[model samples]
Target: MPRPAIHQSCTKIVATVGPACDTPEQLAELIKAGVDVFRINTAHGKIADHEKKLKAIRAASEQVGSPAGVLLDLAGPKIRLGELKSEPLQLDIGAELTFIREGEPANDFEVTATYPKLIDELQPGNTVMLADGMVALVVESVSTDRATCRVTASGEVRSRQGINLPGVKLSVSSMQRNDIANAMWAAENGIDFISLSFVRSDEDVYSLKNVLKAHDCDAFVIAKIEKPEALEHLEEIVDAADGIMVARGDLGVEIDVAETPMAQKRIIQVCKEKVKPVIVATQMLESMHHNSTPTRAEASDVANAILDGADACMLSGETAVGDHPIKAVEVMSRIMRVTERNLIHEINHSVSHCVHPITTAVTNAAISIAEAIDASMIIIATRSGGTAWVKSKSRSSIPTLGVSDCPATLRRIQLFWGIRPVGIEKMASPAEIRAKISQWGKENGQLKKGDRIVFVTGSGVVEKAHNAVVVHSVE
Candidate 1:
């Protein structure tokens, strides 16, 4: 019998690439440490550098015999201040500054902000937090390239620090020039997924999808929900997008810190309820950036996200340029393995019977068959994730095999709850499919003669018509 490639415990790790871990060899090390996905943040690196990293990751993946997915994160519609004599602008509590739509200096102490639509959204008394919320200013008046803002509170704003203006949703969409460029790059590079930063609504998802379609890229579009405006239309966004990312970094900046934990939990539930992969990102292992070890609280946070049904957790600064990059991934993988052990050894596992009627019906049948026969395992032959999705939505408390003809199916299915994808493809015949199932069982130690196993799959190649559950005995 053979072992499963990807087993239960619904936690996956995504590592960001940067100056810290850029080489092919280093990426191979991260992949070895169970980093399921790799992200290329175009916000920091050049396109050529990203292309080089993509090639490096591909070579390493080939060397390791597993296709690791690459995610390109776009620079969202970022409104940034113009150049300062020295950034980290020091201001008194009552100082005033000018924020403009143009990209130039306004005066000796004032500077233009560079987003064409910034002034359009500015309003009197509108609160704008500067440099990741280190400072706050209230809008007094506005013009095309300039706005008068009185310092509501003052603090240092360093170079390229993030600015957040909540309660003033921009009139324009969220896609930025960099995002357009990144989406084009994603299409050209054959990236698996494109994560849109600072997505504010379902319209943003549609806008990006339209762009991807224009470029003829079938890559999945994942909306990065990091704004309050994005939260308002979350349900629609979930429906429009293939996946959702709980981007806590900017989300926290835009919303109160005290509300963030509850918001995170809520978004996780929403994505789960929607049957889309939800990625919990930003500072999962922030301490790993500087230290060799993770805080107990951070480890617990990761575990909690897993229990909350987060399909994947992402590492930003930790993997991007952390001092202990590989170590960070290793730590996270260890955490996932132990957390899964805890679930299997103590907690009961139930398969999902997803929301769709057909999936629910097939899932119920699978569970009934499993219970009546007391089967040890179930085999699900799937493409496009529907078959496995049926098993996932079923809530069956047994080891399920997600066999797929496409490797992307295998990798993408990694985020599904209670699914372990075993890559196998045969276009021969039904007999061949059955033989491969048995062969897999025998090779993986899951199938033995007289053991009853439930097989879930569609009879033909009608991708979405996943409505068959065949019970068979291994012989």
Candidate 2:
């Protein structure tokens, strides 16, 4: 039997690139520690900073001999406060504050918001949350010029802090001006995935997709499920986007904090049923940002996400601004490995529900054959990476290798669960594929003469369709 080239765990790890791990050497270390995808957040940094980070990621990926995918996260329409009269404004319980429009005249107790129309949307008794729900206020009165809110939860707030209205229906476009510009930049730079923040509906996903299409970019658009509306339209959003991310940060604030766990499970279940790759993100190992080791509860969170059938787990501040970025990736990989060990038996029972009927049948049969024969490995030759994605959805315990001639396809499949993208130029024939696999396996000490390998491929017989499965033995 051949050992897995990149990893043994089925669940993938996505780490954000930030000041903590900006250089090529640091990024390479994280990749070597088991980071499958690097997320570049466009919220904090400038375009030039992100460009440099992209170059560093490519260099690091080449250094590690792995095709790591890049996820460019766009900052969607985020409602925030403007400059405050007092920096780090402290609001006391029962304090009355006025929220005026951006250009409205205001006194010490009156505040202005970045969204000029915020005052128009506020109603009496609406709950307003600020600084990621640290401060809370209940709307008391609304006039033409300003809305008065009584502080329900007292906390410190700074300029430009986010404001979340739980159930308020505000007239905000899904894709803001900054998001459109960032999406265009991502398209031009060949980002493997583009994640839109605060996606509220399938239309929101389509909005970003339309921009990408106009630019002739095929990068997968990932819809971030952060708002309560997104949960209501979850099915349609999942169907519309290429992937889903359980963005728990704002989601927890938008909905009740207590409902986040169940919501996370529901999102994962929906993605699994729809055969879309879902990433469980936000604070899986938050404590690891400062500590070298993660707390037991954090480890359990990561484990439970894997147990919930998430294709990938993401680290935000843990890897982006954490002091221990490399160690965070290592710890996350360890948790995934242990969690997957317990699911090996259950994994073989997974059935893929793919849109393509023939590809689904071929992938399912290939998994059954591999498990029946106890094959050393499963190799999938894919064109658009759909075949390998179907195989990955089946959750086969056997180590699977995804071979693609297209460079973009190879990079894109890096995020698929249980599929390791292997670089091979042309695997057009069975004899050639077998020889290449046997030679590479032997060189890597992954296989010997008697080991068996299963090859599933479309072979360009039909465009973007997989229709064949061949079982081969190592020579």
Candidate 3:
């Protein structure tokens, strides 16, 4: 068995792998740089490439003693111009552009749009965005085979530009053929997570869930809230996903650039409040893509993500193809640590504690006992955030963990202050809980074996109460 990762009081760093860091030595450098998880983007690499890198990453992890997690980001629902007629088409200003059907081929410029209905579905005067929202097109006429759109808003258009039809709003599913392949591969590989892209509704999550269930995959699903359709139905996505990712790259493309900041904050808040771990990603360190240092605004962006209750801040191009992959992690880690230390979760969740009579009584008793004993820590076995909030509201100056059988709970509790969250199965019995607590305590130096610790639980009918207390020795 390998050694475990070092203890960081709060927050984590997730690094993306790319051209710059594909080898074992480069990968080991990232892991050594305090990367909590490694992301393999299926969007760019072949399955063989990912397989080689995944093997290297895992081997490195085992060699180092403590293995980190691997996050396989599926190339979900990408709408791209397929097989361009030319590498660099002369997309002149005021010229008309048509998104051709899937089977069409041309010489100058022809986009084999995946959505066969896009041409027919779009109405005259609908706005079409391309190249990560850099270029804008307005539909002048619509036909079954083509939509005559002019470059009313001018910007550079490149080969394989991602086209977005905001007004057309054709019904598209998040699960694509490529996504199915990547997801299936990820599941069989013991990947810790599968990042769902272009998620629009709760049903999308449910649909992906069926695929995951079919493979008996225990991997957690992370919904990337980028589509405008997804924002309208955010709650349903939250309930379905184990966690969420604030994928700002495409999100900024979908919504106004000015609205990106506020929208990111909202997504983070909603995900956190649900006790799910939220990851704030995209351009977090874009400057690092070329230069080693990030701009002041970028620094603030990172700090704000941490303040917004994000459990992790992810690096995309920065660590993937940046001038300094290791430096990027170091800087991000420092920023997160500094920001977290200065900031606090102002929202008090204690007000929502409504419980049945017996559970309420047991909860009150636990709070009283926790306070009276001046305990070093308070632990709660709660599937819901209620039990944790009870202790939080009492203003207990102690570390609290919302222990849960659900991984979603662990991700969710990352937003609350002074709380360490983890996904663990039920302790089975009071004795088992005590035994595990004792082991964790001694190993972490929180308590010694002989030390007396007070344990609290809820009444039988309560949400997360056991109606008992036990004194155990850490051995």
Candidate 4:
């Protein structure tokens, strides 16, 4: 039997899959280096391509003897440019540009959009950001089928780059036809997590959940907090979704670039209070796409995210289509491990007023006990993985194990900070748990004769809520 890949760091790393590390061998290298979760960006690839990546991930997981969660990131109703007549068309300052609807006659200076109704949505003076905010255009005139604009910020524009209309209310549905199809495919493919991009409200999260429910898929729904509307309804959206992702790419474009740092901190703090796993994503190691190492500022950005209470920090281009995919994961893991060393006395989660009071109390007590005894490890026996989540939020420095029988639950908790998902027989009695963990501990060399272990479970409770904490000595 292969041993589970147990990581020492509390914060997790999520790496996006791309041509750089799509092979099973490359993925296995990433898994061994330290990747808690793999993100499949549905925006750039076909369903069949993603299917191949999924298969490679599964094979790599087995080869590495570790479990990694899969995140199916749905490309929501994104406004983007269509094929450009000239590749890498440079738009200088004060240049005139015309954005036309699909199938509309376009000249060399004119462009068409993937959304046919894009021209209709445009009005005079509306700001249009393209190529991830590198190029900016202000609507000068709106004619039938075309919106003539003047380029305020000039940069090279490419085919299929995203277009952002900041502050302009879009009529597009949050859940588009492609999103639904992708969600269906994700559910059918057993993706552990499905993230809805550009989530505007709790209803958007619920809508994705409903789709999964209809398909009998229990994959966790992650709401990507990118739009301004999502921030307006942050609390409700956090409470609605299974998890949250601070998607800072489009978010930076949608909101002021100056506000994104504070916004990222705010989102992580909210998830911490709400006890939902939050991932900080986008350009954490942007320069690493070409360079062998991350810039100093990028390293601090990643470390600060962990310090800000983010459960995980994600790698986009650094691991996807990068020159150093494995190196990026290794560097990220190293940063997390180093940053965590300073969080030994981090604040315990104060969520008594929120949901799962009983489970929260038990996990809280378990953390205190572990700290008091300087225990070697904390063991959270969970059924649906809620107890583990609570313990994870406590942010205890002690190494912890989330033991669950359900395969789905085990995979889902991979995103949780500080708590490693370990498969057990089932939620068992304290004695049974002790025996199993004792065997595991010794095999993994995590426990010895005098070592102490803290266990949190719901053995006495008839309901699913955890209500017990026990301390045991390895004898």
Candidate 5:
């Protein structure tokens, strides 16, 4: 079956692949609905399972011809409760519960935690949150093998639910042994991006980079800023990483929920200044997981992310296990379109002054010329896609058409805001490159007769170095 064309939405959408959208046909639907990237979460499935899904996603993306990217999320040092005697245990307010280090058959009041160093890392009066902060506990006493806690805010606590310690720093490496194996697998399999979870410092980013380099993988590293410590070393971490994800779920649990909005804005602003792609994730359309339609507040939340200049917005459980995954993506796309329409004034006011080299100035000047002349698109022929990335940071109203011969570069630019990646055969000269752009623009229906296009390209003699910009009319 032929897939329908999706509108060119500026803010990219990332959908997680799970039981709901695991098959190639289902993934095709997501691609048709405008998903820019498919995220494979290593925390839920085995490597073999993910390998199959990655194959399906690639096939589906090729069929749709969208060049959708794949992001492999590595499960970092996460703590969870062990098996329970029953499915869920209910605790009343002011009840006492003990968490043991060893796994055992649990009664109503006691359960096992997976992290063996939980007791040693935590002290009395420390707050423990369970089940995504639904249930809260205050520690009263600690023993060699167990920590007894009083339930401050009680609810149903399920087995294998995640545990969050607000201020306690656990003595664990950012990447576990299994995470390294998963990352190696992702690199060997040609994954476009790798998301490191629970990133604390710049050292964590360097460690993952070293692993990728050792494996000879070119996948971009995205640091998940979920811990408060990451906020303290934000600049260093951002400099070390290729991108950043505002993982609001764990961050909200670690800090006051009210502070997350300010933190998100700050992170996005800093990433824009650094020219790094930023993705706003977690609970954007949570209500649509079961319901067919999203609440008005959910729509506003997604729009606000786009308005705040995030490169992408992600859907976790909404696309992973939701009943209306396609509808969710459609809703998000519509909201992005509406929000982008209102951003022209702001984008014009906030011009990027990233004039480090001559190429940066040329890129900025090209965008300025495009915006002033109301050009249909800004066309860039890049070997490494660096010119397209610089134009995307300007946040121009015009869409960027990035032409590249490198498949990896095409896939990597799919995550950039307002950039449409098109793969082309290698051209030998400047005239050949211009002719190819015009041919692609006509075939893709992005340009019509007499339409103006701001074209930028690197020197034909040098690879991956931009030095030329011109405005051409489609013939």
Candidate 6:
């Protein structure tokens, strides 16, 4: 048997593209180190910068011969401090300050708020957190365009820093002009996924989908659940989007920090039940931003996310601006491989049975048959990648090889948990698919003599129905 084309791992890694890994060589190294998805944050860069990075990523992915996915993360209605009198304002405990609407210059004791309705939404006694909750403030009074706040915790506040108003629902459009433009750009550029940040409700997901449809872009949308209001309608939001990302940075500030862990678990559980991918993101490898190695606690956090059944773990500043971008991916991959080895059995048992759809039943059966026979591998031939995705949800110990004729489908499936996607020529029949899988498996060393393989594929000319499951032995 020959060696597999790509390294196989169960948990996916999402690395953000930024100055640290902007060049083609760096991007290629990151991909080789095990970055399944490249995320482009629209908030920080201009369109020209993003286009350059996207081109580099595609070139690097091609050089590596693995279809790496690109995710466009939009900046939703995120409220922030507009500007400071100086770079940073030092506030003492119990100091009084005023927050005025944008376009108004702040005095020494005042700061500008980005959202116009911030004052209207917040009332006396509402808590305001800045700089990821390092500094805290309590609203003492409010006027039409400004609010008086008393500093509860003293810290330095910088320009454009995020402001989190706990329990306050601001009347802002979920999809801003910039977000719509970014979505359109991503759709036109063949981005694999779009993450809508600060998603407050299911309606926000629907609204983004409508915008994408208008632009003729079918990129998968991942709802970033960071706002407190999202918890009330979490089920609807999960059902509305293709996936959910637990954006814990802002969430920790918006809600009690102690509640974030439970919230993360609940979000993952909901996504698991709906058969949609869930990404646990924000600060997983934060210390790696400056250091070449991550702390033990950070490694434990990544492992815990995998144990919690998250489909993927994301790195923000770690890979985007960290000194060790490639090393970060390597470390994350190593951690995932180690954790999956220990938790494979539990993972296989934890998957809930899918009873409704015929395809679901067929996919589940494929896993069951493979596990019972201790098959060497499960071969999934799919056109839209739906069959492979459903089969991956079972989390069988046996490796899953997803074969697709479409490069885009292969790239998109790279984000699916426990799937090693390979691109192949279009097959004419199930017999041809089996022969191809056999040849590929043998050449890739995925199968040797006497190794049993579970072959799974869908029926119908369009590949809509998963009606076939065959067990074959390598000759």
Every model's TM-score? 0.85, 0.95, 0.77, 0.95, 0.95, 0.94
What lDDT does the true structure give each of the candidates? 0.75, 0.87, 0.70, 0.85, 0.85, 0.84
The parts of candidate 4 lying over 4 Å away from their true place are 1-4, 344-355, 426-429, 459-466
lDDT of 2 by residue, 1-475 (tens): 2223455467998999999999999999998899989999988878898899999999998888888899999988888888888787899999998998656445667788888888889999999999999999999999998899999999999888999999998789988888899899999999999999999889989999999999999999999999999999999999999999999999999999999999999999988877899999998999988999999999999999998889999999998899999999999999999898877533323333434667767778888999999999998877788888888887778988888777788889889999998766554565676688889888888888989999888446335543788889888
Q: Model 3 off-target regions past 4 Å?
A: 1-9, 90-92, 102-109, 345-475
RMSD to true structure for each model, in Å:
4.0, 2.5, 5.5, 2.2, 2.7, 2.6
Task: Please list the residue runs of candidate 1 whose C-alpha ends up more than 4 Å from where it truly belongs after superposition.
Answer: 1-4, 7-9, 100-108, 140-145, 150-154, 340-360, 367-376, 393-397, 426-453, 459-467, 471-475
Query: Quick one: best lDDT, which candidate?
Result: 2
- Candidate 4's TM-score reads 0.95
Q: Residue 389's C-alpha lDDT in candidate 6?
A: 78
For candidate 1, lDDT tens digit of each residue in 1-475? 1134454244667889888878888888887777767999888767888898899888877766566678888888766665775666786688988775654564545766666667778888899888777688888888765788888777887656667887886765588776788789889878888899888878889999999999998777899988888778888898889888899988888898788999999898787676677899988988999999999999998988876767789999998889999889888877876776555311212333333466556766777788778887777766667657655643455777676677777666655666766666554344566677787778767678888778777434334354677788778
**Tens digit per residue, CA lDDT, model 6, 1-475:** 1122346468899999998999888998988788889999988978888899999999988778778899999989888888688777888899998988656564778788778778878899999998999999999999887899999999998999988888887789888899988888888888899999988889999999998898887788999999988988999999889889999999999899999999999998888777888999999999999998999999999999999888899999998888899888899999998898877542232232322266667878888888899998888877777777787777666888877777778878878888888776665566776777778777767678788889887544234444789899888
TM-score of 3: 0.77
TM-score of 2: 0.95
- Writing each residue's lDDT as its tens digit, candidate 5 over 144-250 gives 98899999998998888999999998888999998999999998999999999999999999999999999999798999999999999998899889999999999
Instruction: State, as a TM-score between 0 and 1, how close model 6 is to the true structure.
Output: 0.94
Q: Which has the better lDDT: candidate 2, or candidate 4? A: 2
What lDDT score is found at residue 3 in candidate 6?
26
Which window of ten consecutive residues has the lowest lDDT sum in model 2?
Answer: 345-354
The sequence of per-residue lDDT tens digits that candidate 3 reaches over residues 387-466 is 55444434344455555565444433433334455444454555665677667777777777556555555333134555
Over 30-134, each residue of candidate 4 has an lDDT whose tens digit, in order, gives 988889899999998788988999999999988886778999999999888888888889999899999877664456688888887887888899999999998
TM-score of 5: 0.95
